[model samples]
Target chain A: MMQMADRIKLKVLDPGLLTTVQDSGRWGYQAFGVSPGGVMDEYAAELTNLLVGNPPDAALLEITLKGPTLRFEEEGWVALGGADCGATLDGKPVPNWSAFYGRAGSTLILGFVREGCRAYLTCAGGFDVPLVMGSRSTYLRAKIGGFQGRPLQEGDVLEGINLVEARDEPGKIVESIRPERDSDLPLTQSSTITLPPSLIPRYGSPILLRVLLGPQEDMFEPEGVETFFNSPYRISHEADRMGYRLEGPKINHRGKADIVSDALAKGAIQVPGHGMPIVMMADHQTTGGYPKLGTVILADQYLLAQGKPGDEVLFFPCTEEEAIVAWKERRDHLSLVRAYVDRLWRKYA
Target chain B: MSVSENPSVRFLAMGEACVVVEFGNTIDPEVNERVHRLARCLQNLLSRPEATTYQGTFYRQEYRSWSEVARAGIRELVPTYRSLAVYFDPLEVKRQALEAQITQLLQEIDVPEPAGALEAEAGSQREKTFPRQGKTVIIPVCYGGEYGPDLAFVAQHTGLSEEEVVKIHTSRTYRVYMLGFLPGFPYLGGMDERIATPRLETPRTRIPAGSVGIAGTQTGFYPMESPGGWRIIGRTPIKAFDPFSDTPFLLFPGDFVQFKSIGEGEYRKIEESGGRP
Candidate 1:
């Protein structure tokens, strides 16, 4: 158990629309019908953790469209990534994908999202929460894990495990990014380090998601497959962490719509008897009965996660080799950013 | 029978990370057994360092690196009725290499025929031939009245008495095909066709946990309270899933379950005693 003194505290002034503590995901227990609930956008979550120098799997608060208003009880490094939620610290604008130091008693307000659906808020030491089934992610349906197994509410006090010592050295490194700025406070005052513009993902309209034809592609007709790729689908209002119900051209099946329920992989586009496709997301059930037409590639799942309700989505077919190449490219880009951050830390601290 | 004749196996890509090994399309016990056998084999091979040889065939030295990465990459193995979905990290292990390894394993490994198949052919004496039969679990259920709201409906629909419905339901042991829909919810097979009833026209907003129900040829119980369309027949005191417990799930795929009819009094007693029926 960590000592109370070694933890930094944050009080929830106003809980966002849907905010929960999330890590990588809950694995191993899917066989027992457990859903691997986690942050919607893995890319952004990883970047936020990397920005704050937290462990890769460290838990962070995943804020939805409307962001949270939190008061820093102690001084610590914080990073906001994914969606541009118009974050402000002490009434001053704070840039996304940037690591910044927060002074004690400073209020951080994240307003309505202007770019993407979800935003990630990561601190230097990560959120201090008990691990349920080897994860800190909140599975709302089961009411297990996360902060009391539910969304954060007003008056909730969250503790962050203080892994990094708040010495003047690391603070000075953060201040070096904007040394030209004139400030009333001393040299140890708050400063920000932003990620390169090239590395920052652009959230655009009519999101084109690359998909690989499935484990059950034979279940669908050729015309149905054509219809799936040709037509555009709108993310229905029923969308959530479980899945996105797409309202678009009906994907016709050759025979019966139901198959013997099988393991539902993430990003599986299951078209039921009604002919509408429902793309399974982070909190999808372990197994399902509907026939899957295709699965969105691993690299594009984060792009799909950033899409909000009523967002236009177009599916484009890609080969397995193409999917692997796309995944490798994403990995290479992240590695570059990681190396760059490590160099900065090594040089200054 | 030697069981050497291979079933129709297809390696399917469920994106870059997962590979679905489908044994066959139907929900046959033999196919399901193969699925579980393969799952167990992969789990042992991946987790144990010393498990180099499976069924006497030693894996080649060239595939050593692949196995090493597979140990870390292979995140989850989900076994359904006739398929095993292997979720691996694509960055760590390539899908092509993983598929090749699994294909080689399938050819080398020998899965036994289902115990039921052998028993039907050679009578009860041949039960000792197979030692890997799934353990049978007995679940006590309080049928009719408030416990089973649809008991009278089922009785009328099936043209049988309510007592007959209960008797038929408890007669044959059912095999757990898979756990899905909800945590610890068992999708049981081998329900009597006579008692097969259609799902409700309107699904109940809240079906109490432990409420057993029948839908078409399927019969299962709700592990947790949620809105469902299955016809409610009875309620059980025992919890199918307890998140906080060491053994979170009460049932797993390939397990056998037998429903025992009990009175409402016994249900209350078990309910009071922490559902130890």
Candidate 2:
């Protein structure tokens, strides 16, 4: 029913390591054994969407480690967030956590990640993938949703939907917001709109993740709990979207390690008989049999998601009240940024 | 409905976002029914609009409206064997507020007696009173030979003939406790102890979908091709999970299932006719 010309499109020249389409998540269906598959870093994904003047829940390309080579078929506003992926447009360097206007036929190439594990890319209209079970996220194991329910391959074309036509000239918004540009200089090319340095998230190794212990923390012995908190674990190479298996101290259980299978919360640290804790992630199953030691707080989960394989992870125990407060602070920070971005868009566009 | 005098419930925090309301430790039908019932009640309450005032016994003046609670972001409710995990957004609702609401709902539920105990009291009344009233799903399974490589092993372990094993397996109705492990893979209860067998010491890397397998006292069929430890005694032609269909899952918690033994020729016929037996 929609005209092809009205929608902007992007073609994958070379699909990077594990590029997939993701949105907020496929919610309200976990009880039916469905995984809440979404972007690993929700904060980054939301910021990327906001940068492009799109809704926070818009479907965006989630690039893992290596990035993709995509060619814009039409002129569109695009933004990069999360990791510093060393992206370049037509061989010209593009800064991270910034928005820029890509001309039609311009090839955007993303090199290996200079920092962080995953990166997010979004256009002004968002990807036009058919929503499966009320989500556009790609749950690779189930092969549902997103661009054909799997990782993007070479030659896969993606269309941008719900384009908001700017009232002013294209690239004029970026020109007006240019902090360092002189007032006398004429705006010929589209300038980049970068977030303030204080607003950008800093990714680092040996990430300290604060956890709210329990749901099944009593299953572990006092010594096991002590070991869990005392020792630093390295992210195993076996890590993927499903979970990150940590290798460090073998946390012993007081009795049997297995419990009658129960529902798994997001960021649950499940410890099996082997004693190694597996931090369940975006694509974790609805339920698991192993006893959980603790769950990483929602606010710190972004740092955990950005953690690379072999990265050191230190867990700190926090109370439920503290966890709630941390989440509120994160939400307040995002709201501030959203308001700032909306004001900028209103003045320039 | 007459509410239970005092049902033992524990509110365990899964994280800041979720609270696991555990009914009991064991996988009894009564406890599982309560889990499903609570899930249904919460779902019904959440679906209602914001303006409607709830006049329940558990309503407290300090708590906000039902729709405000809903707006506070009750994202998902997952019902398991003895517990229901309620996942909500901590940014919108505090952990204590969500737990208090769930505790209130738990107090309102009428805990049914054990199935055996209720059956003796009033047979006709039991049917009407039961929480799950859905029709039993009959799964046609072809036992032995090439379809089930572990059939002989199961029979040998149980000290029963292969035919006797099949007969006992199909004799009783099984309760679908929950769907987990794999998508639409029902964790079935009510298997005959005579046919009980431990899982394979070395788990097979690739078990075909529709394989009816038993591990310990539990029996279930794989919905998708996945590596499993459950000893396969038979294979079913029916698709346990059809992702393409409007109803993706074939089973849900509190549903009933019955196995019907069929010959290999019938299995082939059903498989050829798109799993409609």
lDDT of 1 by residue, A1-349 (tens): 2222335578999999999999999888887789988888889998887775666688999998999999989766678899999999889888888877666798999999998799999876679888887889999998888999999999998887645453233333432332223352222344335776788887856889999998778888999999999999998998899999989999899899999878998899999999988999999999999899899998999988898889999999998889989999988988778777756554534
The parts of candidate 1 lying over 4 Å away from their true place are: A1-6, A162-191, A346-349, B1-7, B49-69, B111-131, B263-277
Q: Please write out the lDDT profile of model 2 over residues A1-349, one tens digit for every residue.
A: 1222345678999999999999999887787788988999999999888876677778999999999999998756678999889999889788898877666798999989887899999977578899888889998887888999899999999987744443232223532332233331112234336677899798979889999888888899999999999999999998899999999989999999898889997799999999999999999999989999999999999998998898999999998788888888888898788777766565544
- Assess the local accuracy of residue A7 in candidate 2 as a C-alpha lDDT between 0 and 100: 54
Off by over 4 Å in 2: A1-5, A162-191, B1-7, B48-68, B111-135, B156-159, B263-277
lDDT of 1 at A292: 91
What's model 1's overall lDDT? 0.82
Error of 2 at B221 (Å): 0.8
| Each model's total of backbone clashes | 0, 0
- Give the alpha carbon lDDT tens digit for every residue of B40-147 in model 2: 667656664421343332343422454478666888889999989988887777666676666665654454443565455443332232233434899999998877
Candidate 1 DockQ score?
A: 0.63
Let me know the TM-score candidate 2 reaches against the reference structure.
Answer: 0.86
Docking class of 1: medium
CA lDDT scores, all candidates in order: 0.82, 0.81
